[model samples]
Target: MPTATADVLDELVRASALLTEANSVTRLIAAMVEQANDITRSDLAAFYLRTDHSEEVSFKLSYRRGRLDSPKELATNGELVEFLEESEESVVLLERKNSPFNELLLDSNSASGVALPLVTGRSLLGVLIVNSREERFYGRARLQFLDSLARIAAGVLNNAQLYRELQEHARQIEELQRYQENVFSSMTNLLVTTDESGRVHYFNRAAAERFALDEARVGLTLKDIFGKGLTKDVFKTIDTVEQNGQTVLGLEGIYKTDEIDIDYSLNIAPLQGKRGRHEGLTLIFTDQTAESRLKQEMKVVSEERRLIKDMFSSYLSEDIVKLLVENPDLVKPGGGARNATVFFADIAGYTNFSEGKDPASIVKILNEFFEEAEPIIRRHRGYLDKYIGDCIMAVFGVPVDAGEEDTVHAVTCALELQMLVNSPRRTFFRGEAEHLRIQIGMHTGPVVAGNLGGSRRMDFTEIGDTVNVAARLEGVAVAGEIIITENTRQHLGDRFSLEERKPVEVKGKKKPIKIFNVIGIDQQSA
Candidate 1:
């Protein structure tokens, strides 16, 4: 090889290395333009890049007399551009008169130039143009060398463009990931994400604070973060979500330690990736400690209310007892004067009957008698006020008003009590109790009724002239008899049979009060 051919081959080899190693499109274009101007010994060299597979080519970089210049884009419809698009071979413009390529040179007086289309395979990457102030400045030898460089530049430029697009895509993906992390951190509920194998990957701020974890917890297994007790439940729930591909919600468990116990509700959902691929599991924990404790407290309150209602049901009528329990303010210490019926039922000869009897026998007889009588009183809307020695006192129309029927209920209840003790099937003290009988007296009048006692103790009973009259009438009545003052008969409405007895004097009243003995229910009325 001659010296010139050897030098040309050496320059071609260096240009190829530089263009191939160029990392960016700008550097690649600059190197190619510089090498074209040097190899052709031209006064001006410029590169025009194809604009996104369009017919237009834009001015990218230029070299003029060893200096780089940034010029505006070339006219797409110019004569030089038209020739470059139509001719795949090198365009040689030699001092041809009226040739439009002459104007493309940097100096208007330039006489010759050459344009090489930078193409790789069949794709036209761009155009490389060199100009000089000499006719036939770019001969066949230099044109061939520049053409070889153009081919190398086109391939490198394509790679550079691909690299830039990949960088931009990666940046966008990183920004989206940061935005997701911020959203998770702002949540108030605890959130944790893990792989299918239980390896922790992400945990939100709430989860970090609640579990006393830090960034170090990442890559740790569930059992490492939460102790074995809680980890077993968490893994079980995660497995269910992975197997079914469905979210498991509202799973409750206790996170207990020696120092604290927390109640939480858990939700586990499969984390899905592109194309609905199962990636891992996301766990959301809602603190339910306060709500759980409130439920327990309410249960205790409900049980206590039930017990109170049962205890009060023994004395007050069921309706009245429910009212007092629901509104406890009704059981206060104040008393009110209301028209009510008061009744007293006493063992007829209690003092004499118990004189020769054992104390246990006397007590047993009293308890048996009251047990049979109390239910009947309540059944008729009577409040069993209190048991006095061997007597039972009940009142009607006080805590809960029974209107005009208070007297009727009290009278009817008295009749039932008399029949129950005198029945042939009834026995007390192991069949040695036939001698025991009860006398009942009832009076209807205005009486003061309410809870009466000191702050430490209380009894729901009535006191007034009406109660005194009822008690005194019971004291004077004989065995197996139900006596009622005249006030009680007016409210009966012919519901029962009664016999008028002579007026009887009772303590606390100056005049004798007329009384009646209840015989039985009137069969005609029935």
Candidate 2:
């Protein structure tokens, strides 16, 4: 090889290495323009890089002796640009003429110039032009060196474009990761993500605050954070998910601490990778403490209502007891005049029968009698008002109205009580007490009835002349007798067989009250 040709090859080798090292398209294009000017000894050099549009190109022009101008765009259809696009060989302009190559020289008085296409394989990246003041400035060797330099520039430009696209992709991926982290941290429910080995890798802001965890808690096992008590249940759920590859939702449990117990519903799901493989587990905890406390309070209220119903059922009918329990305000402290039938039943000769008996024996006999008698009153829709020693005061149609039937039910209840005293089923009445009998008196009239008493205590009962008249009648009755006043008899409407008794003087009234003996319920009316 000639000395000049050897030097050119050596310079081309060095330029290729430097161009390959250039990381940006602008820097590589500027370096290539400089190298073209140096190797060809041209007065002016311009490099045109293909724009995104195939018909236009952006060009940077440099002069060997003057300042560099900023890049400008030009149409690809120009004579010189057309030659560069079609031909691999450099086009040499021997003299300054009215040619497209002369226009690119600008104000420079160029005599000759050369245009070479920067191409790799079959693809043209751009065109490189060099102009000189002297004629035949681009010799065979100079054109060869410029062509070699264009190939290196084309390869380097392609790599630079790829590098810029990769940088943009990396930036977008980083922004997406930041957005996902913000969404996770802003969640209200506690969230935790753990690796297959159960080591926590991600704990969101809510999980950190709720569990009192810090950054150091990351990489810790679930056992360390939840302690042994709760971790055992969590691990069991995780194991089940692992075996089945299915999500488990709403596993309820209590997280206990010294101060309080937190009720939560946990959801555990398998975290899947891109290829549908299980990578880890994600745990979400929803706090249910407030809801659980509300349910427990309602349960207690329901139990208390049941107790109230049971206690009230003993005195009132099932329907009335239900109404009173559901609407407690209905039984507020107040009284009103209501037409009611009051029945008073007293054990005859009770003081004489218990004169020599022990107190326990007397109580036992009274309890047995009242036990058999109270149900008969309740069965007739009569409210057992109170028990006074050996007497039972029952009322009908006060808190709940039964209309005229109230007097009939009261009279029927009194007859059942008298039969109970005389029946052979009274086994507790033994020896001398076998002949014990009961007398009942019923009166129907206007009476004050309601829950009556002071704030500290109260009882639902009736009070007035009607209740007093019934008690007075019971005082004058003999054993095995059922008595009723004329007021009660009028309401009975011939439902019971009655025998009129002589008028009885009552303590509370000046006039004597007419009373009757209840023989029995009329067979057909019963």
Candidate 3:
């Protein structure tokens, strides 16, 4: 053999050894590129692997060696990939000025090179390019030697791919097995599996603890484990499933321990052998004793609350009645200071409008107005404090913290009330209350809120400066206007469009409070 041919044979032996010992595909591909560069005497070598063979070919892996100025990342030549798809043979370029690979190799510092398509039978693996900075460096003889090397490398890579696929399948199986083990160990239900002869084959952790049995009972029969307590009915259900190969789902039973009698729901599934013969059965036991007792207790509570609601329905608003029923302590004698927002809404000029109306008609109109407005307040998490003649007082952030948006919700609720009164859909708007308008005012601060009255008859309400300020603000409002103190506006942020109004004197305050007239809600929240 000649000098070049002898060198190629030696490199092939080294390459074969590396492939046999290789554990990872990336490390193996790196070895092949390094070997190709050294044996072919090139300035740079790159292995470009085609991963997808769709309408658009994707070169997924590009490994390069022997160039100091090469790009940190790799780029592929679409034309060269197309060229390899058609040609079975290799291509050599003595000058790359007008070559198809000129653009891809522009930053590669190449003058002459050989491109060998690594293939197996008819399958295209990748392209191995060996390029040099010297012109006319690789001739026909070197190209042939590189082709032989390319053929050997491609075969090793194909086997490596098969090995990698096997590893992935093994990893997935291990993961599935681990996941099943974790799920079984974490289950709260008692699970037991037995062979056809009633010999215990498997008992999960819960089953072992519930039955007070240890590892020594693994091979014990059902009669040995449960003794005379393995009832005939339970055994019959298990036998029916094994004999007919049918499954029994959610069968309830009672198990007696020394301390208590536990109610259990069982699910039995038939197990099969290699030839589809009945082998055994799996019993899954779920304890339903606590759940059964809880349902009974809930029924009693529901009956009591129903009676409570019927008695209070005639006296209080629906939300307050429900809240007080569910949490009776909230309406007890005293209360602590709570951060809250108080909203006051009064029907403006209501006395003048009701002058000519009858007493019965006036009462009907007041009920109609409250019916339309109270739900809006409750929807925004405000508690209906009271209906003081023509005014409605609502408190937010009480009974519970309705969040920082309490003031914003109060403003939004006020805006919605005006919309409700002016709405074309209201029958009262076109009838007796036709030109009706409301003035709503809101303020957020600390207040003492709870039931307040003598033992004769207590009332759930708030009493503080916050309540006084909110009521005073309502008195200053004109018809069809929503006025809010500066304190409430500061908490409302930019959620509403506000028009600054003249300052007004409030009761029990030294300085006049500055207020804003809410023109309209913002488009985003509207």
Relative to the true structure, candidate 3 has a C-alpha RMSD (angstroms) of 9.3
lDDT of 2 at 500: 91
Question: How much lDDT does candidate 3 score?
Answer: 0.78
Better of 2 and 3 by TM-score: 3
- Model 3 agreement with the true structure over 1-526: per-residue lDDT tens digits: 2256676577678767876677777887888888778767678888778776566555554688886334433244456666765785777778767777553352456787776787887877787777788888887557766787788788888888878999999999999988977777787788888887768988777777777778898888876786555578988887788788899999887888575466889899988888987778888988787667788888877875664466445444577667867975554346768878898999899989989779898888888888888778877777778899989999887766655687877888888999888888875645757888888887889989765778887666788999999998898898988888888888877778899999998879999999999998777866
lDDT of 1 by residue, 1-526 (tens): 1137777788889889888877788888888888887767777788877775475345444333333232456666777666666776667787746756754654566677777777666666677877777887776668768878877787788778778989999999999999988999898678989986668989999788777779989999877877743757677767778798899889888877665466889898989889998888888888688666778998876775675576467787677788877865554446788889898888877787678778987888888777777788888888888889998989888667778788878877888888888787775524566777888888889998766779887666788998888888887788889898888888888889999999998877889899999999888987
lDDT of 2 at 155: 75
The Cα local distance difference test for each model comes to 0.78, 0.78, 0.78
Q: Compare the candidates by TM-score and give the number of the best one.
A: 3
Give TM-scores for every candidate, taking all chains together and pairing residue i with residue i: 0.48, 0.46, 0.56
Over all chains combined, what TM-score does candidate 3 have? 0.56
Over 70-158, each residue of candidate 2 has an lDDT whose tens digit, in order, gives 23644566666666667766677888777666655533576777777777777667777777778876777787788788777777887
Stretches off by above 4 angstroms in model 3 are 1-7, 53-57, 66-122, 132-148, 178-190, 193-229, 272-280, 294-398, 401-526
